[model samples]
Target chain A: MTSSSRIQRRAFLGRAGGVVAGGAAMGARLAVPVATAEESAGPAATRKSVAIIPPVAAVAQPVREALAASYQIRMLDPFVRFDQSLEEWAAGRRAMGDSLRGCDAIVYAPEPAPDRDEASLDELTRGTYDLLNVAASQKVQLVVFLSTLELMADYPKEFEVDEGFMPTTDTSVRRMSLYLAEFACREFAREGKLRCITLRIGQLANASATPASAGPLSVSPGEVARAVKAAVDVGFSQPSRLANWEIFHIQSSHSQARSSTEKAILQLGWKPDQD
Target chain B: MKVLILGANGYMGPHVVRKLAPAHQLRITDIRPAPEEIVNEFPKQEFMDVDVTSVEQVRSAARGMDAIINLSVVRQDPILAFHVNTLGCLHVMRTAVEFGIRRVINTGPHFAVAGPSYEQMDYRISPDIPPHPGIGLYPLSKSLGQEICRTYANQHDIQVLELLFYSLRDRHELEPGTGGVPFLIEWEDAAEAFRLALEVDSKELPSRCEVFFVFGDIPQMKFSNKKAKELLGFKPRQDVSAPWKRG
Candidate 1:
């Protein structure tokens, strides 16, 4: 089979085989068939937990602060954004593992470096996989990633310049970033250890945005916090392809200047407090 | 009372066991093979292997139990979302009815009330939306599952407690977002919600069939927890700003 076919098959089977039975025993795996029912039901309580792993940087501080309000979260990256030593980074990851040892869910924020150089993307990608592996070891329940919606729009030509593959030209760069984020989420959802979520956030209307527009298409840090809280509070149905690795456009209701992201707000029950 | 826990081995199962073990006789069933450690912990709880889809197995498994807390779902199949969530729910409810059991606390997502759009802001969603749009099968399935619960409540005289659960968390994996809106109900709060649903009077619930948001009192809660509080008397004790305790 071709590599693409293999990947498709893997995705199919991963979804099919991961049917979790809730009670005395979960759905039987073909391999395990049926273990003693006594062995099935108790681990769920003691075994499951979620962890958040954010990339350390000036930009991510707000995001980190937002996650803390609603989740049992821990930040793994050092405060130093660009100046950390190799030892510091390693210690940070090791420390992350220690923090995540007993958890079953992981909300990951893998920040893209200012320069999307091959080395930076490659390192971030590899590091992402490494985090996935760590979650797998701990049987983490879900993996949520903060992906960029603007990455596609703000630098569409640049992204094409950087990476030879561009999937579609139909949508705007921002919408395309949402799709790309989904692609990455699909790629990383392996071993059932990682259930990726790419928050295709629109232009963040923090205090940092240049010359303010009169339109209502802006989102604030406070709004982002409320959105993330909704994502966390809304318990998930079984982690399936339904919403798994899905890319959501993150914006407020008033930001309906374009279309509205009322769909996400409705799904997770998120109501952002406006400035 | 003899109680049967579906998904008895899940994140909230052990906690359920902890809560229910004090007074009732508990039996747990799941698809996962029983873990040795849990066996050692609750030696008295009988574990059984039965798929909720199989009506015969459900009937047989539910025969002597007073209540059934279903927590099973199709993990991978988007198409099976409805079948597992709705049909499985129907089967469990029907089984409960057959066995003369009245109370059933089934696990459901808060998204059943809201949809993908609701994820952006924390707001109250009425249980009256015309089912979730078929965005994906999971929400559809969950919406259908809620329908089944309503059917059982109306037709079979079974009291169904649908906990519209969201962001249930442990200490490590939880992420309380920064915005002032509260979301993510801590696991302890979830436990309390279920416990109250299990213990509270049927009249005390919202309408004959009720949908309660099983979330902590995060400042920016997507679904309103007021009904849950009013009916079930569950007050979330966790702080909304503790994790991101901002100035």
Candidate 2:
């Protein structure tokens, strides 16, 4: 594909329009229609509503704060804990469906404790699966699934794996679960039900520390919050593609083997804030 | 027909084995030994403990078989998931080509081409669309496996049938929205798709490497299985939804 086509395929809505408009201007003079009163007011005149699922996680708090700065934020209750009978699971699915209704978009960040055992892991898996289903059923326009950079563990230690590298062949439950979540989001995105942006986050520093830079390896919570906000903004602005999904490696900038931040920079207009 | 079935202990393994038992001579292999009931039921069929990830084991079992059907999958474990789903496929395709096996049937989830998120639920998705094999390791690995099949098919002139299944379970077990997608397939219907895939004359196949959506007919959903219906004669025998009206 031509570089221009690739950009059109991968660029965020606003930039993509600029590219198209640039191309059109060189071709022919076209009649422009007069703007209506509603059209003149611009997209910002109406605030887009975003529903944040399980707003209790550490990541969720920063993301919520960042999003609340621009969009109208709605916090869905914490997801039903995984250890429940079939009846309870069904009820939880229904409850999730109810919570997501009328929301323009959703931010899903399930925070299972780090020391979770097999049962808890299973719960996490099931909960994610159910949540995806509910989101689809509710017809939410965009879903920003918070995934971790741990998926990069399987990459050769020396290789600087970027978003373009295909996922490695690890089969650990954690990696597999994250992979499945990514799959579900992409599947929904492909079906044109919503736009899914998977932020493969790096190691998060303490909330208080102002990291000097977004090094290639690690990122701070504040950086993550900003990334989430950028993604949410793009999701609202872009017209969802039938196969509209993207994976970006969110990390601090580095001189060594740059953790390919080009896609995030170009698409989301996101640059890591070192200060 | 002499058929080698890998991952014969999975949920669909026994059903497939039982379905193919009457007409085809079968050799079944899995990491675990085949259950005794299956052994007793199909006394003529041979069972072997074969780990698909082990190229040697797979090569050994694949010898002298007319065709190979890969059912092996690891969903939860990342290491084994890649080993089995991706590398295992490489072994199967390579072995099939080496042994002059003409046809291979590979099973995978529908997410391979269904795009990741449900953002485009308004129109039907056909098999020909470039696969958007969503983010997770399972689908990613499986999609890679399909790529392997495509490579072998194109390079070696082998007929590779990649069946993209939505959800495969018994009719009684299927719920309204199986696997969180608007599509599902009863085990029997899935088995029938496989059987028909095996029976379709190679000359009739549109391409050497082909993908077919193997799910119960759900016109209401945005996925189309018309290719499977027209090419392989895949007649879905069960509709888990609205079961009372099923004929």
Q: Which candidate wins on DockQ?
A: 2
Report model 2's TM-score to 2 decimal places.
0.51
Q: Rate the local accuracy (lDDT) of all candidates.
A: 0.54, 0.68
Candidate 2 per-residue lDDT over residues B139-184, each given as its tens digit = 7668767766775687786899998886666666755443445567
CAPRI verdict (incorrect, acceptable, medium, high) for model 1 = incorrect
Kindly list the per-residue Cα lDDT of model 1 for residues B126-216, writing each as its tens digit: 5545443233345545765666577567666678888876556665544434343345766766777767888888877556577776666
TM-score of candidate 1 versus the correct structure, residues matched by position: 0.45
lDDT of 1 at A84: 38
lDDT (Cα, 0-100) at B6 in candidate 2: 96
First chain TM-score in every candidate?
0.58, 0.74
Worst 10 residues of 1 chain B by lDDT: B128-137
TM-score of each model, paired residue for residue = 0.45, 0.51
Candidate 1 regions with alpha-carbon error over 4 angstroms: A1-275, B119-122, B126-130, B172-182
DockQ of all candidates, in order? Answer: 0.01, 0.10
